[model samples]
Target: MVKQMEERHSIWLRIFHWTNMIAITLLVLTGFYIHAPESFRLFSNMDTPRMLHFAMAYVLVFGVIGRVYYAIVAKDAKNVLFNPIPDIKNLPSMMKYYLFLSDSHPDYGKYNPGQKMMYTGWLVMAICMIITGFILYNPNLFMGLGGSLGGLIAVRVIHYIINWLFVLSVLAHVYLDVSEGIPVLLSMFTGKIPKGFHDSAHTHDKSIGA
Candidate 1:
């Protein structure tokens, strides 16, 4: 059989995706080290991890801004953003397919409802992390904000929780992508996938009915 390909991700998006991945990974590692040098022991000294952590935080800030700009300009928000009414309605079918209770799910365009929800949640979480991190990074600079949030301790706690959320969500994201197939996982790197890769299940359903 001849294999055809279709663009699944744009070049700019791939850039942002990989860039943010690196930044987030480094940030998480450095964060663990900074949080407890004795336990993590991933770094030799506080100076290096602290510097890398702050640097990656800035990288993440720009990566997010670039990704959002690209999404808006490319009109790709519809592919990833959650729509409450229709997406909520889509939940049952998607869940059924994932749980192996169904062989096929309705075609959900570029992404399933679950993916849309996850992406949207990640966006919100990233924004929250940025805000809390900024406040924690410089309490004096954001003293009013920190005080309003019950001081630096509270802000630090919020930042830490969000970091863990990022970790767990990224794991789930990778699992879901790979579960679909190796092609799905590679699409982010290659920016293309075998045409109709996502629609195969729905197409099978149609063929069976016909």
Candidate 2:
């Protein structure tokens, strides 16, 4: 009898992943529209941009929270939220593997070392954005953060910067699916991966790195 494999990304992840794709794309479009193209105002003075930006911001914030919620409820949040903490010990080893030095460094199961690091960075950056956003949203309420406006501004800057990083990650993610010889796209949509690939991962084989 063949050892039956199970799906990793649940229905909720599929829903949120696609929903987030939509929200993030809209945010980018509305964000760029309002970003200093002075002659191309869609509302005579860019009033529409502000409304759209705020709306998308709300959606993104809520969507992120929902994703974290699902990750928690699904019991895989620990690995998804924060794994591979990227310590000094793993630093050299991870680099070696990336440089093709050694493929036996470690087996990261669902997310490899680099991906875990990215996820960690995303979580921290998202928290920073949320905090700074609150400050900017209601500076009056955050009494001690009067001088914290600079921090809020910093978060704004980082938020935009991370947007590209996020997009880049998405690109790399897609490219890996296509180039790495895997049906990652279909797995995402159908919540299924070839059992051989799944087995490779569970068995900690040399070809399981994703």
Candidate 3:
């Protein structure tokens, strides 16, 4: 049987997806070096990676803003935002599928409950990172606000913790995507997926109104 292709991601979404990925990868690398100048050796010296880190921080800021705008305009929020009630209801089946205890699961939306939760968490984490990052970047300017949050040391600690979370979450994300099948992974790059990929897994929840 000949399989048709379906558009899974828009050109703009794909572009932003990759741009954000690149920015995150660079930020993580440079972040590690900055966090531990003696241990991490991805860059020759602190100066270069520090510059790159600050530059990429701005890229991520705009990327987040643009992506949020696109999601709103494209009405894509339904596909990714975690709605506590329905998502909680669907979690058992999703967990079963992940645990190999179920062959099929309820179709939550474009993304499963797990994916929705993760994506939403990333949004929160990114915002946190940005806020803390800026304060750290200019301690004096943000000193008053930073002090309200528990001073510079507290902000630094939160930033470091979030950086680790980003690293670990990205690793899990890559593994889960590849495990689903290469086609699933490629869809983010090519913006298309084999026909019936979703159907083969389970019927999508049309009632969610994405």
Q: After superposition on all CA atoms, how large is the RMSD of candidate 3?
A: 4.2
Candidate-wise lDDT, in order: 0.88, 0.64, 0.87
Q: What TM-score against the true fold does each predicted structure earn?
A: 0.94, 0.72, 0.94
Q: Candidate 2 clashing pairs? A: none
**Candidate 1 local distance difference test against the native:** 0.88
| Candidate achieving higher TM-score, 1 or 2 | 1
Off by over 4 Å in 3: 203-210
TM-score of 2: 0.72
Residues 50-137 of candidate 3 have per-residue lDDT tens digits of: 9999999999999899899999999998898899999999999999888878777876768999999999999999999899999999
What order do you get sorting by TM-score, best first? 1, 3, 2
**What are the per-residue Cα lDDT tens digits for candidate 1 across 22-80?**
99999999999998899999989999999999999999999999989998999999999
- Could you say which candidate leads in lDDT? 1
Shift in Å, residue 204, candidate 3: 16
Give me candidate 3's TM-score against the actual structure.
0.94
